[model samples]
Target: MNALTLASASVKSRPLHATLCVLAAGAGIALLCAIFLLSGAVERSFIRNAQGIDVVVGAKGSPLQLVLSTVYAADVPNGNIEADQAKRIEHDPRVAKAIPLALGDNHNGYRIVGTTPDYLSLYDASFAQGKVFEKPFDAVAGALTHLKTGDSFLGAHGLAADSDDIHHYHAYTITGVLKPTGTVLDRLILTQVESVQQLHAHPDLGDPDAAEDLKISHEVTALLLKMKSPLSIMSMPRQLNKTSNMLAANPGYEMARFSRSMGFGKEVLTALGAGFVALSALMLLSALASSLAARRYDLGVLRVLGASPFTLSCTVIAEGMMLSLAGAVFGILAGHGMAYLVAVNIDSLQGLVLPQSFLHFGALDGALLGMGAVTGLVAGLVPAVSAARTDIAGILARGRA
Candidate 1:
């Protein structure tokens, strides 16, 4: 018989042992794959959010908190800064662009950001319907907001749909709706800074045209600043912290430190997974060694049928590799399935959107299959060598005696 037929027969003869090796290796690969997918997605999201904005200037607080709040919109602001203070930074020679973030009100849990039209340029946003906010109380909805241009919604006092403080007096008109950009902006409600000032100043609204005279405090929650040059980071951050009362944070640095802090647990899990893979190799070796003892007579008969020593050795090795291939394939599928479920739940509750690449496996996954095959080949080596040296003539003579 050919080597393929021999290898198939060997695995078919011992199903339980084969399954044990596959399951162990599969579990290890599954955990690793899931980690790879999740980490890549998270890193990409952070990097994308921090693009263009070099410095985050806000009231003195946790630097990490400032970065998270301004960049990711996942945290509360660190107190407000004077509108004049932010404008001073905007006109500074070292600053390229400055977008003031005025955050407070929300509609049905979606945050309403009070900023100028320049904020839309940060995400390269284009209107899918209508134009930008032209008048007070006029709003531009995100693509995911499910609101059309003419639709009007009451703004909640806080960032919660179920918030107790609801502004029943005023209804904000959606003058525009942004196209889906796959960024955090897809979940926000954008309106003129004047609209937010009006929302807080007047609780009881009358007419849109008549309310233009009302005024509120000139304060912003934070400032997103971009530098004119790479060299500006060193002097500007220090100056902002030392000379000014506000805090400045570098998102890239904060994110790396945060990732390092979170990495300890992931490293431990990886070590455990490696332990399982090693155990799988051991089990495969033992199973192959044990099988050789019982299969010597069959192997000798094959040798008598004109199969060479090398062919017999390769057959045993192929059987082990086949088991590895099965395990690797199973592990990859299981890992991605878990990631998909997780991404779905996160999107449903949290506004963080994972990219299309997160759901797809790349070259590393294919490399895992090859790695598994190598593992099996190493485990089956000693047993294959023993099988190749089987005494054909002696076994036949003894059986006939």
Candidate 2:
């Protein structure tokens, strides 16, 4: 019989042992696959969303929190800074662009970022529908916003446009819906910074009674600054902190900090996966060793019929290879399916989209499969060698004893 037929017969003859080997090998591979998929997806999402902007200027607090708040809209602002201070940074020779961020309002749980047209330019973004806000009360929605055509955002004060409501307010028109950037920007309701000031300042603006009593303080949550060169990156932050109450933090640095803090758990998962693979190899070795004992009489009949010791060893090794191949095949399919399901759910809730290429089982996957096969091959070697060294006379004597 051919090697394939022999291996199939061997597996079919010992169904329980074969099934145990398959499950052991598959479990190791499944965990490894999950680690690869999750890590790749998160890394790609972070890289894509964090491109362009170099420095974040905000009130003194946690640098990581400032990065998360400004870049992802994932947190509330630390504190407010003077808009004039932000504008000064804008006009600085070393500064390329500065985008103002005003916070304090939320449509449901999502934060609203009030910034200028420069903010959209920073992302190089475009609308999937409608246009940018043109007037004071107008607003633009992100891709994930549930607002539809002709929907209006009523101010917190319960007043709408062209109305004489008790409290002063403005009606924000839903002019545009941005295409999903797979970034935190996808979750924001963006409007001009001046517009937000106007909304909050409305009570004092037209009323002489309120205007005389108004002690106004126009402030912003943070500022996104792009530098002209790498040199300014070092000097600007130092100057800003020494010169003003605001602190400058590098997004890239804070992102690294956040990733390092988060990545420790993922590394632990990887170590656990590696341990499983090693344990799987050991289990396969034991299974082969045990099976050889039960098949001693059959092996003896084959040897008497002229099968060499080498041939017996080859048969045992072939069994190991067959099990590895079957496990790898099933593991790969299961891994890919799991990745697809995870990606779909994450895209729905987090807007962190992953491309098809991210989950491909290309070179890295092939290397893992090869390692599994090698592990299986090694697992059979000791058992195969022992089986070949077995003496038929001694076996018969032991049976009689």
Over 128-203, each residue of candidate 2 has an lDDT whose tens digit, in order, gives 8888877665677877768754677654421112333222466677788888776666777788776666766666
Q: Provide the overall lDDT of each model, using Cα atoms, as 2-decimal numbers.
A: 0.79, 0.73
Clash pairs (backbone) in predicted model 2: none
Residue 167, model 1: Cα distance from true site in angstroms:
2.5
Model 1 C-alpha lDDT per residue in residues 97-150, reported as the tens digit of each score: 888888877887788888888888988889999999988788999877778999
Go through the candidates in order and give the C-alpha RMSD of each one to the true structure: 4.1, 5.3
The TM-score obtained by model 2 is 0.80
TM-scores of all predicted structures: 0.87, 0.80
For model 1, the local distance difference test gives 0.79
